[model samples]
Target: MRTRGFTRCGVIFGLSVVIVRLIGGSTGLVCYTAVESLDLGCLLRWDCLHASPNITYTVQTKTQGDPWQDVPWCVWISSRSCDVSHVFSDFELYNMIRLGVHLSPSSTVWIKPHKFDYSDFTFSPPSVSVSLKNDSISVKVQFPCATNRRCSHDACCPISKLIDPWTTVTVYNERNRSDNQSRTVWTQEVVSTVEFSGLSPGQNYCAVANFSFPTFSIAASPKSAPGCVETGSRWGMLPMYCVGLALSLLFLVLFLAGFLRKPRRDRTTADNPPKPLATVQDADSSAPPIFVDPCDIHVELVDDHSSIDSFHGFHKAPTSGAETKRSSQPTHFDHSRGVTVQHEVQDMTFESYN
Candidate 1:
């Protein structure tokens, strides 16, 4: 009886070691959170033997009523963890989906579905950055798509290939909190950046981005906590405050410059007030001003004249000795009233009339 019991113990220990060797390694799951609220994303980790014949891992997922389905196109997983840098980038995964680990028929484990209440900010926080462009909010968020999976159906090795993770973005008025949702955008594309225009400048806005996360293996969310970035294009209060500050500084500078400049008193000739100008200058650049000797006194006044003509305007001289000169006083006439006002002239001189 003692010999038989020893034989059975040795057999059992050998079988256990054989099973561990066939499985390649052990896998553990942990999920946690940085905030007291529900966790956001999770991390999956395992030991990897970097050998010629690398160990392969396959993951499966299932919803409430759905049957067990393999994650898409993922033939063999080489990484030790499921993260942004791992196979998940190729295979989209999300939260609320149950995960199944399949290495071989002998080693398989199922994880419970991760339930996250994202409607409440306290429970599920968003990872996003907001900026103000011009009365608009430009939000940039690299939202992780569904778990990166490559579960292709091979004749030799069959797997599933279907990844669709819906991403939702929301821009809300901070005053309204989560109650008043101003705008919401939804897409499945991997592009992580979007813009929200037609926003009221100088208002408070909050941008939040939320998407499903495929979590397994981890009992807690990773240390990289999701964050929210508050910003606007041009209407946010912060931008408006900056603009107003700039304008105020400009006004202050102008005021200071005006105050520092000296003021001059109005001046008028006391002995001889400056004489008023008569003829306005024309645009002719060739005609130069003719200087008058101020001492010369002359006036050729006519009572009945054909019309007012240019003063001291010259005509072609008929005789060599006699210069053809036309002289007349500055005169203005009112034909309706038959009144003519003539100014007494001291002297006037010019070269040409054209």
Candidate 2:
């Protein structure tokens, strides 16, 4: 028999699905008043009937004869509502899509008091003037290829090597129009290093760069440019290497401190203790040797001479004065009935002979 378990991928996929369902609902919507402003482009809206297969939409211009004249560009239809992709995002604004719709420069622009009627519905401010200009402008912009090298303060990592060697620079210039869209001017390719010239000089340009990242969304995003202000090259593996080196040094130090220190081995035991040997001192180098008389007339051999107990294991030899005194001491014997005394100098062995 075999058992099955969920893998990491399966768990991640399940969680992602749950999160999408929770946050990806269309129940969030709010209604508000509609007012037109300077940001004017062709406006169109439709309430998607739940049963309809697609949304039928139309264009209502707030400007004309402008650099960007109004004409039907694209039509999007979704089950819920067609998200006017550049025109109106899925956000609720009093006037979600405002083109420079106030009034055209050539005409006396005023808000139409009456709500104009449409085919299927009624809309307001059906007509307005084209208040815009068309002219060529130029500006100087620093252009650098995103290379794999370090970036300097003034130089940008060349965008080419940063994302793709052949990656192009896309610049979006939205002209005077209703919606912030209709302003996509150019997505030109930059193939040079120093600086790019002949850019739309005076107008505001919104530019984004692309680079490579490990994340899927980040890699797929067009704004992958890491700032050139701080770092020149990516510190990919240097930090990890430094951390590993530090840990290794720390472990080595700990091991040495724990095991390599000197132990207290200089000790002794009772069986083999150190002994101070007796020192041989010179008697008196200046004194001459004096010989005493052999017989002082009263020489007597004492019996039961157990009093001289100095011959057992004495390390020092007895002096002459000590021997004389020991010889003069009286001796008492308990063997009174029969006691015999014998004297010998060389082989003197003492024994009680009865």
Candidate 3:
């Protein structure tokens, strides 16, 4: 019975040792580093080889010759990251800062502290946008510090006040990826707007930018996500020109047609003058019309007093039956005093007397 009990105890101890080794080897802190963000200020990040449901983490920080202090917002948190930007409120950018990590329920084990200065923080990549002009490409870069609330409130924020800042821009043609151009420009503004000319029209171009601040000892940020734009075609104005030309030609043709038609109309009017319209008579008028016979009528004028008196005193004698019958018919004649006289009978013609 004693031997059996010893064997059971040995086996249990061996199993316990094996379980402890597996947990310790598989679950341990991997890496820790400081990140400087444009929007969030400074942050501390860490990673574990394997995440355990039961393990919680604590982060602590200390400056030179200062006692270790637990991050107020990061104590006993399961998250592997925390914001320590507030720790830099004192504007001690040159001071040496150290971070320590503690795992709960395993208080005996502690990770080594990581030491760094505020200036050593890595910068996050900036945002970028691209636009196309007639034959050029324009790129605009926006840094994170421009929109950070903390930087706005704190005038001493290093990121907000950059020194000797510049951007490296690279332009790539989408059709030929190997065909690219690069330029570096120094800018003092929060947002950098740049124009790149001498590019092929009707081609798709992409731009990427990385920000650098040599004064702060911060390395260049990671390249921003690519922004793309297509330039205007070289013949983009062809349609407009064609439309304008067509309109001009149409106007010229209309003018010529009007000019030619006017001359033709004038020639026709000159060649064939319009005949005078016959005078129209109103048949409904109440006035009577005078009738005159111009062909069968004859007139005689008398200027001698003897002829005028003889005409007044003359009386025709009685004629034979046939002559009376002919004389009975009406005769159209005129007699004037002191004027010449002429008469005509049915069987005899009388000459005019002066």
Candidate 4:
């Protein structure tokens, strides 16, 4: 039992020595300040090792005759305590930081300024990125980090990563050099990115970011070096014009085809071979002749003794004298001896009516 007791005492002593050695050089109540000493322009910090990690700590401040304001610098509860390093004024009555454990919170502790012989502090600004959008411009502010803080293998204090304070931004038209007009906007420190509207299409713009606090103010690192962007339009009429042009070309092609082909179709119809006629009457000599009566016949008898009815109306073949029968006549006959031969004469053509 004595041996066990001795071993326990040795273990406890070793743990105490480790604790003292770890926090020996730390300032602001040891294991509180980021650096070893509380020199000029240094941060003052503290943390409760026994506090619950689930609870939150708020770093609030109340000036004379003013409501309490919550400064977001070192506001998270990773350290189980709050810090004040960014913004402060020498004229304020007191700055209170509160650690709330559920409904029952510890009393608000007033933080006094860490006084020093000299007071002027210098801070450099970070770079600002400018991006172009269809109708708006986006400006992103980035803060530079310390070499040792970012280079550390283990994350000793995560609170230092949140460094951006409240900022103000100014944007203006790049081409409006004569008028010298610009727009001003205030941005919260928590928001690293901000957008400005009322931008015209195809127009150039310039913007700059500025950081301001109650105690200090700083502009961008490259002063007066503004970022520029050119705006564009989302909707364009080129597609519509192209479609209309295509349609017009199609119509023109159709018109040309129809107009040029009409003549060929008409010529084909007009130049067609002629069809045969229905009747083909030709002159023929082998067919019988045709005739019709043109007049009526009339004749008058003279003092010749031959009977008028015996005179032939049309000519007939003359008979020989031997076959002629003798007729009574007022005798001027020239007859020969036994065969008396007589002469006869007749006319076939008629003259006009008298």
Q: What is the C-alpha local distance difference test score of each model? A: 0.40, 0.28, 0.59, 0.44
Compute the lDDT for candidate 1. 0.40
Question: By descending TM-score, how would the candidates be arranged?
Answer: 3, 4, 1, 2
The residue pairs in collision within model 3 are 301-340, 302-338, 302-339, 302-340, 303-339
lDDT of 3 by residue, 245-307 (tens): 999999999999988998898898899988975544443244364444555566443245654
lDDT (10s digit) by residue, model 1, range 159-269 = 111222234566766666653343334444444556777655445777666544333222211221323334444434567799999999999999988876634222323
The digit string of per-residue lDDT tens for model 2 on 1-354 reads: 000111221222221110111123355322111222111111222222232243232232221222322224532213221212233211112222211111123322111211111111111111111111222222212233321223333554433222222222333454522312112112133332212223343444333333222122222223323211111122544687899999999999999887655342333354467897444334343345544343422335544444334433122443333322232333332233233333332322322222
Name the candidate that leads on TM-score. Answer: 3
My TM-score estimates for the predictions, one after another, are 0.27, 0.16, 0.43, 0.31
TM-score of candidate 1 versus the correct structure, residues matched by position: 0.27
Give the best candidate by lDDT: 3
Tens digit per residue, CA lDDT, model 4, 126-202: 45788976577888765443222233435332212433344556677778754223443344343467788877676
Prediction 4 TM-score vs. true: 0.31
Instruction: Choose 1 or 3, whichever is better by TM-score.
Output: 3
Candidate 4 C-alpha error for residue 290, in Å: 83
- Candidate 3: what lDDT? 0.59
Clashes of 1: 36
